[model samples]
Target: MTIDSDADADRERLRELIDELAVVRGRVTLSSGREADYYIDLRRITLHHEASRLVGRVMLRMLDEAGIGCAAVGGLTMGADPVATAIMHAAGAEDRAVDAFVVRKAQKSYGMGRQVEGPSVEGRRVVVLEDTSTTGGSALTAVEGVRAAGGEVEAVAVLVDRDTGAAEHIRETAGVPYLYAYSKSDFGLE
Candidate 1:
């Protein structure tokens, strides 16, 4: 898919911002129980006002370019909230009108009692999102939840891919497109 020169330039600038503000080097344990010499705290950028806008723009552009039609964008709560909200607002600003949803780690035993909150995803095409991907565990949870709720997972998008084979895992397991805005090497990691 072709991107406009202006959007491409913005993407480059966003990459610089992410590399400068998000990537950190040190021994750390990831959510997937893996040890790494460097960690990517994408929330540092995904939560930033300006950075979030750029992220939304880039991600939405990617969805548009890929020609994937979806009724909504969503994923597990916390990390996916900002990305999905940003995408929803950005799409609204452009008159695209996509909805957003948040998936709970566990179902609440109350009113609605649903695992996914927000608009109904049943029978809808949805894209799962994440702030950062390590082993694809969280994204997989989201994908499974969406499917179990009768939503078709159109794809998975992440702010950063640790290049640890999660993308392949997601594709093999979910049989859906996997996309990321950046990778470990994007921040000069090995």
Candidate 2:
């Protein structure tokens, strides 16, 4: 298949896998505390190899669509780590090079007192990524770290949005567009 066709297939497969893996239920108190009837725990799929590959494809497609020049793809550590690694690998496979950074929840007491690790982001374009977003606080925290380190955040992307107004919050607070691969409706929860 052509590259475009392959990317499309990957995106479709990723969506299908997400639909299958996501648990749809009621009474889940989301991070936003709006009482969501469903949740998309992307970690269920993100930790799986096949799902991670598909997710990487989808993210790369999004980056291309956004037309933003990203020097690095990163966000708050732990959850964002694997997703960022997948995107970086996919970019390498596609012959597009991009760096990845990690933002710690707390500044390290040692080792240069670093909050953002990996490639230095100074004066470079960046895209903050997350596995899931509810209130968008964690993602915004990473954005703040990137900015403090002199990285220009071009956009933010999440694997799933829990319908907690995070997208709007990020837009209003950070003035950056937020994108999601799937929502509660995609998993038949809405």
Candidate 3:
């Protein structure tokens, strides 16, 4: 399928931002437990205004292409927060409303004592997003949390794939198709 011009532009802009902010160098250990010569510090981009907007647009386009219905978008906190906020804003601009959520690393110590915060996902179609995926463990943790809360996760999307086999691992273990906007090869690090 063809990507719309606006979406393509957004994706390209995000690529450029990643190239500027993410470190490209020698071997390094990633959270995914894999070795990589380059690392995409997605936090760097997510914290930047333009980069965050581009990410939101790209992710929305990807969700449209996948034909996945989602009422809410979220993932393991911190990394997914900015993307989810951007997505919610972008979707609203398009007249398609979507809620954003955050899955805490640990259950809250008080109140409702919830792990997934923001809105009730029960019976809603949700998409769990991540800034980067290396081993896919963190993303899966969010997915499982969403599932346990009764949200049907249609898929998972990450900003970068380090080519560390995380995508395959997610597909096999979680049974959810993993999507990424860029890969190591795309950044000329492969």
Candidate 4:
């Protein structure tokens, strides 16, 4: 498949910016109950106005390239929130009209008591997003929630895959394809 040079350039630029602004060297514990010598705090870039816009465009392009015409983009909250929203906005700008949903770690006790919130994904194809994945636990959790809510998980996309068996695990456990926009090595971190 041929990729547009402009889009390729944009992806390269976004990658460089993320490496400069988000990658850090330090000891940190990840949400997946793992420890790492370095960390990729994508929030630094995902929260920035211009960087966020770039992320949205790049991600939308990726989905297009992958031929995943999902009805929605979503994943566990906190991390996936901005990414999904960005993807949704980008898709809308392209007239694709994809919505964004967030999966709560636990269903709310009051009101709707819902786990998946946004547009109803029942019988719709969806893509799960994550900022960074180590064990794929969080992504899989979102997958389970989405499935329980009657959505078909077409794929899972993580901003950064830690290469710690997340992709393999997600596929093996849930039978869903996994793709990462970037990986730890993209930031020069081993």
Candidate 5:
């Protein structure tokens, strides 16, 4: 979806914040098991006070502009945790109805024995959020978890796209649109 000009500044600000706070130059092994010269450690921004606020606002605009209405926003834990909360709070400030959920790696052996936590995903449309994606495995896993809990997977929304195969991989594998706010060029990484 095309973000309007008003959001252009917000998206640009987020790109700048990512360049300043999230980019890490060094050899690193990604969650996708791929080696990278630099890592977009988005938690640096996703958890940052100012940057997190931008994340919420920009991501919410992205979703809204895409016309993806949903009852909840969330994805796999850790990376998706703050991002989801950011969107939830942002939507609330705008008086939009949105909840958040966490997808556990595996169902807890105890407690409610649930793999998906927070507001029940049963019979609701949801957009999964991820800080960044290389293989799209995390977001796809969240999709499976949500489906298992009876939620309709609307789309997979990522804060950044690595220009890797994740986008294509997610679309082919999950049969849903994969949306992202920025790409490598946004931070001059490409």
Candidate 6:
């Protein structure tokens, strides 16, 4: 298959998984504090045995396609944890040198006093990953924390975009490219 077609197939399978597992249909308030008819709780997929590999493959493809080369990938803790680790595993499978880090909401009070943890993002190009993004708060915060830890902000990427202004918000606020592996339309929502 052609490269584009292969990418399309990967995306299709990822979407199928989301539709079957991650997509929650009902009233819900997102972390961004907005009410929605449907919510994409990507953890359900990102933590799954099969779907996690798919998440890793799809997101790694997205980054390579964007010409975004990062030595490390991660973002604000809970939401970004699995996504970052998945990407790291994917890169490892390809023999790519990629590490994963975690960005804490705040610096710890003691014991090395770190806000960014893992293989040391110090002076490395890093991409911030989010499971789902809405207003861009979590991603932006991660970008800030990474920068403070001396990591170069390569870009911010999300597994799923809620399409609630995160792309533009991150662009305007962080001055970095914002990318998503899937969007509201990918899940056949809205």
How many clashes does each candidate structure show, in the order listed? 0, 0, 0, 0, 0, 0
Candidate 3 on 1-190: residue-level lDDT in tens? 4557767778887888889887567778877667777767888888787888788888888888878779999999988999899889889888998999999887788999888999898999999999988789888999989988889998999888877778999999889889887888888877
Tens digits of per-residue lDDT, candidate 2, 1-190, equal 8988987788888889888786756578765565766767778888887998888878978878878669799999988988898889888888998888999987889979999999999999999999988889999999999999999999999987777789999999899989887776676665
Error of 1 at 120 (Å): 0.6
Instruction: List all candidate RMSDs to the true structure.
Output: 2.0, 1.6, 2.2, 1.9, 2.3, 1.2
User: Per-residue CA lDDT of candidate 6, range 1-190, in tens?
Assistant: 8978877887888899999998999999987788999988888998999889988889999999899999999999999999999999999999998999999999999999999999999989999999999899999999999999999998999998988899999999999999998889877788
| Candidate 5 lDDT over residue span 121-178, tens digit each | 8999999889999999999999999999999999999999999999999999999999
The local lDDT score (0 to 100) that residue 190 gets in candidate 4 is 88
List the candidates' TM-scores in order.
Answer: 0.95, 0.92, 0.93, 0.95, 0.95, 0.96
lDDT of 1: 0.88
Q: Higher-lDDT candidate among 1 and 2?
A: 1
| Model 4 score (lDDT) | 0.89
lDDT value, candidate 5, whole model:
0.92
Q: lDDT scores for all predictions?
A: 0.88, 0.85, 0.86, 0.89, 0.92, 0.92
How far does residue 100 in candidate 4 sit from its true spot (Å)? 0.4
Instruction: Give the candidate number with the greatest TM-score.
Output: 6
Q: Which has the higher TM-score value, candidate number 2 or candidate number 4?
A: 4
Misplaced by over 4 Å in model 2 are 24-26, 32-34
lDDT per residue as tens, model 4, 101-131: 9999988999999999999989999999998
State the lDDT at 102 in candidate 1: 95
Better of 1 and 6 by TM-score: 6
Q: After superposing candidate 5, which stretches have Cα over 4 Å from the reference?
A: 1-5
